[model samples]
Target: MRKLILLVAMLAMVLVGSVPALAQSTLSGDQGANPPESDGGSVRGIITDISGSVVLVEADPSASSGPKGYFTVTDETEIARLEGDIRIRASFEDLEVGQQVQADYAGPIAESYPPQGEAGSIVILDEGGETDREATLSFELEVECDPPANAAFFGFIPAEGGINAQLTDPDEDGVYTGSVNVPKFPPGPAPPGTEPVSLPVQIVQVRGVIKDFGEVKIDGDKTFKATVSFCDDNGGGSGNGGSSSGGGKTLPNTGGVLPITLGAGALLVAGGLLARRLGR
Candidate 1:
């Protein structure tokens, strides 16, 4: 009995230390099918409120159908404010209520009660009704995926009305269509004499995780025609407007941290059980 007691105590201590290590070693280099592919999507609206990395966008009455979606802004995400002529780099610290913005996003949005995806870029469409010209950002997503997903969408907030495109499994192949109506602001500073008041139709930007991404050519296509335009009054520069970078918050790795923690927890439980059995 004494020898058995000593052996059990040794085994318990080994578990207390070794189990966690063994689990980590097993999971360290894991290459399991790389988490599900997050398809491309977008959300546009007013920054009605904000908290953490995700900000709430409130839509006006003319906006399209769909619940107000929350978008996750990442450090890699280009947070830029459109001054008179430039897309100046900024961050969450520059954002505020009533400001109009367009978020181009991709990847899987959270599956919580209200789904939210990460944003790759957040463009401050306008600082404050500085311009009356409505710019449209129109792009068609030619999609191709191995396994089909039920739905994917891209959205944009006009200075007044918001628009979003919803793509689903194609009628023929795995292809789909989507569009965005972004309230137009100047892409960059132009000559002081000419103000753009014409409604321009062109492919401003294309974002998505569609396998074999289709060509999004920016050849200054005919898509750019200004129905109405605004004169360049302010040259482009970064704005001090944005939500704090969470003071260098760790929202980046939040997705991968869960599995590691769960593994550690399981190991601790196993260790406790082994120690209990040994005591008995």
Candidate 2:
């Protein structure tokens, strides 16, 4: 009968070509439908100024339904791995100043910028790009006395010194940042009194070691200030500590009595000049 009408018009063109791949696998449930002409290149903003590696985002031009441009994030460690706590998500969580953001970006497409300045634009979830390969150590700190406003400034982890993390300044305006992960700093000079002498690192798992430092607290005052940096695998930098403009210095909680009181006053002035040269 004409082969049953040619198998019913070849099963109605294979069910209309499987209805757009089963409606794109049921709206990407299993992942398979991101192409309505797919742009995948976006950037919606409102982050006005961030200094030190520069970040001045302010383009919400109506949160783009599509098409509209003007971007700049120039990689400050990818904008601190996409704003982890940048003064509390870009200024006290309200995230205002024209609140709005959307970013996807691919990479490399400069017209006139790109010296060390180029994240191009990727503000989607506000910031995303840190698979946790583990290795982060950022820096900046300043506070020469005056820390008791609420008390909460502790950071020190140069591979066993301990206490690695706890800092705040979400625009309270005192200057203190964050980052941590330790277990590597064996190049030299870090075991003597240990107050940040020098540490610049970027090495993963050879024994860890990711440090980003800061310290400060002021409202009533009790003394506080610190700034440090280190990242293992050999490739990171920053260092500084108490006294020398960092203020705050009083240490000496016993033991070794201030170098044994300067070695017993230099052995009583060298035994009274050797008993006056054996009594002349």
Candidate 3:
């Protein structure tokens, strides 16, 4: 009986000692798995492809160069979609191709030609990092004199190329009618770490570019003006959305396996103690 009790005590000590070892092993395994923790870096680019949980990004999109590397976004990653004045919390599944994103690393990037890293957070940005809203300007010009062939229309509007449009005279009438699609760009730069603010543009000028039309008139007036509004209700926003000034921060690394490991260790220790008591 004495020998048995001694053996049981020894066995109990061995089990107690093994528990911590097991726990340590479990912790190490949980932390050491592939796609290691990010040391500290970030990449801002367009997401080109998504395979399973991995996302391929094109770091130098301006040159259409090779994809920089693959980034994996896990459940811990924080994803946000930014519109002009709205922000939506999103997930990995919500990610899609052709969208610009700023990805923050969750671990040290793999030192490969095309690097690899885990995404700690992702923010979807609008194309060109600017809010693009479109408006339409329509006008009709009546020529008092004979019209010239191959004549074009121009608008003194707030847009690129001076808001140019083509006027087509379907009938033989002297009235030439056309509409210009005007895109509204942000009036000014956005505040640092914020979205660009959009204001209404009350009025713009539309004119006839008829160089040979001796006289051009609209509503018996020499010059024509159109009212323009950039309100949200008028569908003035672009479908691609807007840019994000500041993106999400990195999240703390955590593991669910630790709790299960601790529970198993506790059970082993309890079983060992119970056996020792029985031996006594």
Q: State which candidate has the highest TM-score.
A: 3
Superposition TM-score, candidate 2 onto the true structure: 0.18
CA lDDT of each candidate? 0.49, 0.40, 0.54
RMSD to truth, every model: 40.6, 20.5, 40.1
In model 3, residue pairs whose N, Cα or C atoms come closer than 3 Å (at least 3 residues apart or on different chains), thus clashing, are 37-107, 37-108, 38-106, 38-107, 38-108, 39-108
The candidate that wins on lDDT is 3
Collision count of model 1: 29
User: Lowest summed-lDDT stretch of 10 residues in model 1?
Assistant: 228-237
Q: Give the TM-score of candidate 3.
A: 0.31
User: Residue 208 of model 3: what lDDT?
Assistant: 18
When 1 and 3 are scored with TM-score, the better candidate is 3
